[model samples]
Target chain A: MVKDDMANLMKKIPIESVTLGIGDVARATGVAQSKLRYWESKGYIKNHAVTDKSNRKFTYKTVLQVQLIKSFLADGYTLTSAVARAQKRAIYLDALRSFFEDRFAQMDVADHTATIDLGPFDPTPSKHLMAKRTDQQWRFYLATPES
Target chain B: MVKDDMANLMKKIPIESVTLGIGDVARATGVAQSKLRYWESKGYIKNHAVTDKSNRKFTYKTVLQVQLIKSFLADGYTLTSAVARAQKRAIYLDALRSFFEDRFAQMDVADHTATIDLGPFDPTPSKHLMAKRTDQQWRFYLATPES
Candidate 1:
């Protein structure tokens, strides 16, 4: 009885750092296995090898990529454009990160008051900033400074 | 003959404010008529008029909205989320407009030098300012002043 209980307890424990199988990824992302395979074939995603032939694994990031591809397809984008846009989304996010990282260093907070110094406003840059206040108010600003 | 030529000229001229038919919108936006009709039925879009029983008209804004929706969907957002995101996009653009409008009033430009006083930076706010120098340099600052 003690041995049986130990085995059951071990079975109940999941590996927290799991590399998901194809089926697991499909179920978690609401995407089809066939589509995931196609994306892999097209170089949109990479598959983790689990065995010699039948079992394939995927990381959580690949699962997210597959889910994003499905959403793009449903939104009427062609496969190539969707992939390109997905890449562009990453670049945009990186730019946003850098933008915030630089600005966060200059922020000052005391009590309910906060202040920011926007260096310069650009007329031709594509992305702009939106400022949100704690009281639910917000504002926007251009990111470019004239030289 | 002159009167006939004048009439033909008038016929060739397009009215600036004309509402677009489904086919016209489809051709202009590169979206299929079927998808446009489906989006309309799904409440992701609205028809300007339901003329007769079959003819549907869309406003110019709807054409722009469809393009935006297509782009968002291509970016891996769900239909519902895409619509919501598109609306947010409009609000963000409006906020950007207001941000620049207010800041532009404070701008001093002379030769290769420009100065803008965005006041102070705040740490507690959700939005912050990212400043980029046109010479490929960048910085970030909070957009709030301490009280």
Candidate 2:
């Protein structure tokens, strides 16, 4: 029964179902092949099937990560900074999806469709506050709670 | 009293705080001056004082917006898309800041630091979802609620 349950869980999770080529990833993510290669060289991204320097295969998830990194770069972050943000975002997204999956699985058994309070999406204000506010803004808040 | 409050509110906000030249904006944001000029020309960003083609003054907010746009562009979005995202982010950030101010104002009167449930940090998943999921992922969720 445990074996069956494990198999079922594996099936539910998107566990390495499809593989994509570098070209496919570039096309899917709207990122140029040259940039993709550059990112790989810079260690910002990795190719799973690094059979050769010229030929490589990547998972769909890698494509997603590349897209995330690209979007960050587009927003004006340095390549290094973008990569860091992408990595952190990936972890956060994975946690959110896992939470959703676990909750959805339980909800299926009960057949209930009520709003689930996924408490405190992000607790840290600094993490979400992409822009660093000036000291004045902070002082204003501190000085005048009524304002 | 009302006029004084309005004046105080404007003063507290980062409205017309500091003006920066194109060079300063570029240096501060790590964006090219040429790109900043281009963005301004294209109406994506604004300069507070446009004296001539060569000389312009932008607010600190403009510098931040330019940085945001540049990051978006690096992420592989079209220039137009990046601009749109930057605009949306500006609006969202303002709303978030206002919410924080209101909450902080109330908390000051209460003298409490309890966990204020600012529910649904991300109401729109599409805006926040860095990677666009294929239909397969959605179908999986729909088909296998039990999983």
Candidate 3:
């Protein structure tokens, strides 16, 4: 089970399976259901396909995208431009996620200090990268597996 | 000068002074001049205030935002959603930049191997973080300043 959990953590989360209804998306994002529907119609957002046409479901990613779009709109971007900005942000979010998934190895806490193992450095099988956080400061270093 | 350069490296790059013309932004981002103007007029994007209204100028940040917006548009998001996405992505990019600025200490290369110093570990002034790269693999470890 632990191995299975580790394998699951290593892979990208299947976003398709975790879904929410339109109402939930609206509430979570503070976007009106009608506005979400309109954005979907215009291809500004997407929803999962369902057997019933009236039953609209969206992924958590869409929820985040909607929140971003709403924030951008509030920041004075026109609706059209806000959506564009949101889509572009998705790329960065994806990159951050990938970095976490690929590099994050293990974390240990002792005596209130936390050590984060960032996994192996590329091309060097003998060394691994790690960071220690103490009182809000992070220090990075390299260590062998035995250490 | 080396010290000055290191100080500058530790700080965030001042982006306000780096300005470009609308034409340059359009050329770089593949966005139309008229469209950019429209976005500016709608407050979708901001430009540096110029003395002459006819002479429009944008900052480098604006240039990146425009490029992101354009890319999102190509990805099928509505213009508004794309702009929103771009704004959200800016936050992530900022974080990445901050991480590099705060954590990256120095890099040394010799014998086809590169060592990246990530600065001192918190609370433990005696230890510092370092990563060695050889043949694409990275190994992280802790070392005292003498080492």
Highest TM-score against the true fold, candidate: 3
Worst 10 residues of 1 chain B by lDDT: B1-10
Question: Per-prediction fnat values?
Answer: 0.03, 0.00, 0.10
Ranking by TM-score: 3, 2, 1
What candidate 2 gets wrong by more than 4 Å, as runs, is: A1-13, A50-54, A106-147, B1-147
lDDT of 1 by residue, B1-147 (tens): 001111121122211123546765675566899999998998878776634575677654566567667777889999888787655433322332233333322222223322333333233344333343233345334444323
Q: Each prediction's Cα lDDT score?
A: 0.48, 0.45, 0.60
Scored by lDDT, model 1 comes in at 0.48
Highest DockQ against the true fold, candidate: 3
lDDT by residue for model 1 (A1-147), tens = 001111121122211112455665665566788988888888887766645684666654455456556667879999987776555333222232233333432232333323333333333334333343334333444443323
Determine which window of 10 residues in candidate 1 chain A has minimal summed lDDT.
A1-10
On lDDT, the leading prediction is: 3
- Candidate numbers, best DockQ first, in rank order: 3, 1, 2
Superior candidate under lDDT, 1 versus 3: 3
For candidate 3, the TM-score of chain A alone relative to the native chain A: 0.76
Output the worst ten-in-a-row residue range by lDDT, candidate 3 chain B. B1-10
Off by over 4 Å in 3: A1-147, B1-13, B50-54, B109-114, B122-125, B133-139
Could you list the chain B TM-scores for each candidate? 0.48, 0.55, 0.72
